[model samples]
Target chain A: MADHEIVIAGFGGQGLLFAGKVLAYAGLLEGRELSWLPSYGPEMRGGTANCNVILSDTPVGSPIVQHPNVLVVMNAPSLDKYEPLVAPGGKIFVDSTLVTRKVERTDVDVFYVPATQMAADRGMHDLANMVLLGTVLRETGCVGEETIDEALRHVIPARKAHLFDANKAAIEAGKGYVSAA
Target chain B: MKEKVLMKGNEAIAEAAILAGCRHYFGYPITPQTEVAAYMAKKMPKIGGTFLQAESEIAAINMVYGVASTGKPSMTSSSSPGISLKCEGISYLAGADLPALIVDVQRGGPGLGGIQPSQSDYFLATRGPGHGDFHVLVFAPASVQEMADLTGRALHLAWKYRMPAMLLADGTMGQMMEPVELPEEHEAFGTDNPWAAVGTGMKRPHNIINSLELSPERLEEKNVERFERYAEIEKNECAWEEYRMEDAEICIVSYGITARISRNAIVAARAEGIKVGMIRPITLWPFPAEPLLAAADKVDSFLCVELNMGQMKDDLELAIRCRKPVDLCYRVGGMIPTSDEVLDHIRALAEGGR
Candidate 1:
């Protein structure tokens, strides 16, 4: 990756932190330079949250990014908070069912996947972040499919080992949504 | 020592302290430095060490006092405001002349300052923390590796000086990631600390670790004796590093995390054909006055940049004691002054010509 910057945002319970950690771990697996900084002030205790994921083939500068190349907005607040900060010709993946507000910008590509409805169809409400991750991997080709699978294997600790099948199914459902879009 | 691990400053200190035979750690959670307590919480049980999350900073340092009185390597850590609460116990520790390692990974503060790294506690660390004329051996480490190195050194110095020792760091130093090499493990793990309150065990006289004595004259003797030890420490334990000062006309002096920022400024100033260098004092208590005095004789001027309103600059002027006053460059409240900002001050000072 030359410069792959990701912004994942949502309310506190939406697994935004876990999704960002997986991306950072994927960068670690690829042996690339990366930084994972979370919105730690008011966004910490069950409030709206966001994390910045930056991966580079070389050393990264300051970890904070004012303009991210890709955004995965999980809620309306996140969409409203981060929509305009997307770079020109960047991608915005919004949960169509949750994020009702549409982007006004014409230069960037926006995809409304109704990801929560898709997860509900698959009976995996908690796997929304995984679905979004799969769509991001497929659409942006940010990381190879094989590398992401390997990264997911280590992201969840051994104590939660039994949830693997659900996570994989979530990824497949998200991949299917990307293809449909 | 074997593998080169990229570690945060907090985790490096926790691991190094364990290797240095410190098995008991008590701390309360504070930002930027909480990782130190968390890392110990995770690993201490596996290594048979004790990690306690105290209810308050006051309780935490007193818990440290309890453990340190037993004479095993024991420690506690906190940030600026939390450290202020622990000052009473630290004063008691000093009055009793007990050896313990207290780490202040300082955050910006007069009260609840932002959690962005700061070197604001220079005066609190170097001068006596609480009431009375007691001094702690304060060590300032500039890098993550130095965090590990100086933790081990701080433990050793606490034992040597028979007083409380502190590793004073800033939030940036606590939160940053860097590569570090741990010192090789040796046979000192089981050695008995001479002052530990490990009870005489029915073989020798019973020990009491207390700061209070009924008589005032004896307390005065303790005061004079501690000062004598301070004199000895000043003689033997002063540490400083000088960079590119051979032909430097302006010296940029900083320590803790600010020194790293100034190191960058020093390089840029030199690239712009300015004769600016940096003098970093590794130990803040001794204050490295001799080196500054010597530098004053060599250089045309000196600039001290700190995270507080001229805390360390106060010491620099006292140390140099020159006809010309030292220039102060400072930032407060968790803000990091960039290299360009510091270099601008150096340029302006050079142009101002004393």
Candidate 2:
């Protein structure tokens, strides 16, 4: 069982926190210890927002992820700030639609998924975060894909149940894109 | 076994308070802790409980005092600056020997400090919240599970001791989410208070709940009696966790979120062959002196890692009676020390001893 320290960074309304929650829920469903911490306060209103998610076989220590092995950036600023902090041999998932800059690091694997463009193409303008999350899952295999449905059920409230199918479709689209690429 | 659910620390405290039979919540919203009030507002009405967004922190605490006078479980929560506004009411609760739960999700502070995690209120909480010699039962939680568990415990202990109790957390603990198995709802223990000022029902003498002892002698006696209860509390209620202490040469003293960070540092340092362990104080008021004193006889030195500028270091020094050298490693003004920073301190201590 591998441990994953994941950092998801993007604009406030980009659903980064929700993506992290989905990952955290997947970890929980598998009986792995996990923690999710977001960049809170005024920054969460409209500025840069980020969340740290850790899934460990043992009890999690320090919810703050100073060094993330799995880094996901939905924007260029997030890329510039967090790219250098990824652990060596780690994986970086970039939203190529929003962040066009190439990752400079040669020590880690980089996945450039046009998540925003892909989601928009599929009429899931708000689901780019989920698409990016799908890429992270397919690449790292940090958590099994079987837990996605149950995890989504836990996170998406009943009132928004209408969007559940779209979220699932978006994730599948992302997984399919990664496979074809 | 009860199923576990993921919840933020602030939300966990609110739900736990409800499960613990706290029917009335009076609080003013403050950052990093506003979730507590939000949860209560949504749940309290449905459960026939009262959740009032008091006009001010002062008003909120006084409302708690009113509910507490009737021997009911009541609570109020706030961040650092908001807590400062409730100091007078807190003092009144202490003077009258009222037991109520106060949750302080502390942020960086001296005056309207940044809305970031901090433990700078160590002295403000442990020494006393306001103008008095009384001590509240201060419980510091290092995890979301502890955040829920200690809330119930704090309420029970407060009612039992007839003194106020506090759940001292920071922004990190309040905002972080973790899986926790909340306690089952049950009747709160020690709810039957003989001294309560519930209407006498025309049978017994009226229970006068007042802190105004005009006579110098009577006031002195009342304070002395409270101190006696405080002594018993210190003896029986101190709570702490010791990790990897069996052969440790360097001991780390920390609590709340800082304790979690220190645990990571200790593990990393141990991997590099440093004999380091941690003594995390769960009960800040009681100070967990016995364990620190015991560790003093074993470890070469102690390091107090905190979010404040060495506030808890004073307590560590006093607890161990200066038997071993104690050092302070800290960050303030909403900045949290990273595990690497703490690891550096532990390494420096290890090398200094060598």
Candidate 3:
């Protein structure tokens, strides 16, 4: 059975929670068992924000992932905090535009996508989270790209439907970065 | 199967309450559980229901009492500190034999503790929600689907027994999102109570809803009658799930988020050839003592995995009649124990160590 315990962490307003929600929705659309848990309280106002997302073929036992098999870090603090906690042989997707330091771990595979810079260059300023998510999908094949597109329809409200194309573009840019590397 | 949608546990409780025929919701916002009130506020108005953000938790609970007296399903939700404020109102609802749903998405406690998850309110919900020799039916949900399913069941059982019911959840349960198939919209069960304080219209004696009985003998009688109904509920309404217990020697007793965490440990322990299983109590007030007591005869020992400092461990010992050793594995003050920690405990027990 496939079980992907993913943790996404970044500073507040970086859309980490929204990215986690999209991944959770994609898992749900595929009829897989999943759980999404966000860190709440004062930290969400302006400090670091993180969410634990699990997509499993079996029933999810605990929503809290202590050692995530897949980690996505969008900032230096997030990378510093979660890089060591990734399971051996697991995958790490880093937002290289915001995080300056190199990953010190050698037991896991790491992908550095300039998500924020790519988003800015493509005029998808706040969609860096989605770009990082796209790198995760490209490297891991955790969920299909078409499934993520369907998930966006469910997550982005009808009032904000105009940003769907931009979000998609950011994701494609993320995948393109990984391919070019 | 009905279509499933991803929803937070708190939102599931709100939508499930509406499906259970609850049209009145009164609550004050609190972290980890504010989504419940927010969801109700958004949906209730469109459904022509009453959604009032009361000035205080006390007022919100009293609103529930008022609507409940009219034989309509009503609900209120709060976190730990806010739940403390509603204790007096909950006691009043119990004294008046009112049926209402109260949700407590607990945070750390003693006084205004952190807004993170904790199971420290087990004693608060089970022992005495307020100053009274009374019991409110308590249901603990471990998943978002159970959060929705048990919300409907809690309201039904509360009205069936003419008492208040509480959904005892934690911050993690409230904040976590999972797929759930909500209950269908149906007529509210057990709403046609003869003792409702609806208008008499000059047809019969007016039904008065009051908890004030001046005479000591009558008050004692009321308490005795309530106990009799509680005894019946204990006999008929104990709900629990026994996982991999057919030949298990080590029994893990837990509920809510801790139960989910324990399941992971149990699965890992089983892989290591340790015969560990779990008995998760769904109805905490009823305690599900029958299953625990029965397991005592078969299992070598019991391990309680909880988010509090051995709160449920005492109940486990009482339920098992102290027949076997019951160890406590817990974390408190808004901290949650990882499956690795719980697995270490199980491993120790399997190795004949404390």
Candidate 4:
């Protein structure tokens, strides 16, 4: 692809920004131009949060992805806000457990994943973001699995290095979830 | 140490300042630009430097004035309202000929505007951020990497010219994240100037630094000398970038975040054979008037995009002497104009649909 714009949105504690950062880093590792912009608002913590991630062979013009080719929404509010903005023939990954309403656009491809439920089943309650990331990787092929793995190694802070293996497992399980479906 | 890493624009600017040998940082907390101070607070002490959270923006700017008078690189940053509070100190710094760096990561406002990205401070920065007929070298960075790069350049130019410099950025540039290569670390600028206020100790007379000259004639003389230096800077330091201008019929003029969006619109317009180009001013103070004047001879018309009510458009009109029709496309407050919206305007202008 010449360029790919993605927006990941959810509540504040959902790691939406982190997922975007990881993807941006992966694009950097692949030597593509990339930008990651996080939403800044008054109510940060329990408030709605979103981030725009752009990957391009050419330099990215605006970091704000007004119309994204791919949107990953983890909550109902995010789905409501971003669903109408998805480009035609775009791909949307909706976390079915949190976002109950089906996507309304027929021109775009919508994939429903039980990210929260899958994380719960795997006993990793807060890994839904990673699951969605893996599903995005499988659907979009925007970043290689090796790049995502390498990016994860660098992105996980040294203080939280112990969680790297578990996060890797979550990613694999997420990709497996899609293949099985 | 990794040379490239994902970094926020605000944090990148702080890291770049540290690398540029700016050991003294004084700032107050404000929205959209608090990260610059937070980064300095966390890292300055670890690097054996000073980071003071002053009581107010005015105090922070005065602290910068003191540190810079000693010939060491020092800086303070704020949002639009807080920067307004620092105007007096900025004028004092200019009057005393002390070099310092001031960053204004702008938000919307004539008064405590929203903490969203805005380029409304263009006139304030380029036309004289402070009073007393002085000009601060203003650099408008369009990207996160340029935020880091220009912070270093801004202080360097300030030190070279013995004048205050300002990095004109916005909330988007400060909050966004991208890969940046941090500058190599350097020692703090040496405090060994003949004009420094350091105690003489019977070694050549004492050097006194003060902005109060009292005499109208003396102040006028000082202003004349300062304007001379500014003229030299206007001749030498103006920087800009031209994109797709070789065969362009219409040229778009912009800077900062608006320039980033214009680049996308120009690219899209090109694919549709609209023949659009861009001129992005990097140095807002030493505004690149000459190239723009030359481009007026080539392009049919000019479209100026800004995040404010067409402030920079006046600068473009003044530059090209109103020889070409200069159209304005802008949005006020903190709303960013979308690329598609800009493209629509460009398409209209191209097809004579305007």
Q: List the residue pairs that clash in candidate 1.
A: B69-B197, B70-B197, B71-B196, B117-B172
Candidate 1: lDDT of B135? 95
Residue B123, model 3: Cα distance from true site in angstroms: 0.5
TM-score, structure 2 vs. true: 0.99
DockQ for every model comes to: 0.11, 0.89, 0.89, 0.75
Best prediction by lDDT? 2
Task: Write the number of the candidate with greater TM-score, choosing between 3 and 4.
Answer: 3
TM-score of each: 0.75, 0.99, 0.98, 0.96
TM-score of chain A of each: 0.93, 0.97, 0.96, 0.96
Q: Tens digit of lDDT per residue, candidate 1, span B113-140?
A: 7776778888888888998899999999
> Can you write out model 4's per-residue Cα lDDT over B135-175, one digit (the tens) per residue?
99999999988999899999888988899999999999999
Model 3 stretches with alpha carbons more than 4 Å out = A179-181
| Interface Cα root-mean-square deviation for all models | 4.9, 0.6, 0.6, 1.0
Segments in model 4 whose C-alpha atoms lie over 4 Å from true places: A179-181, B186-191
Off by over 4 Å in 2: A179-181
True contacts kept of each: 0.00, 0.86, 0.83, 0.67
TM-score attained by model 3: 0.98
Model 1 misplaced regions, further than 4 Å: A1-39, A45-181, B186-190, B323-325
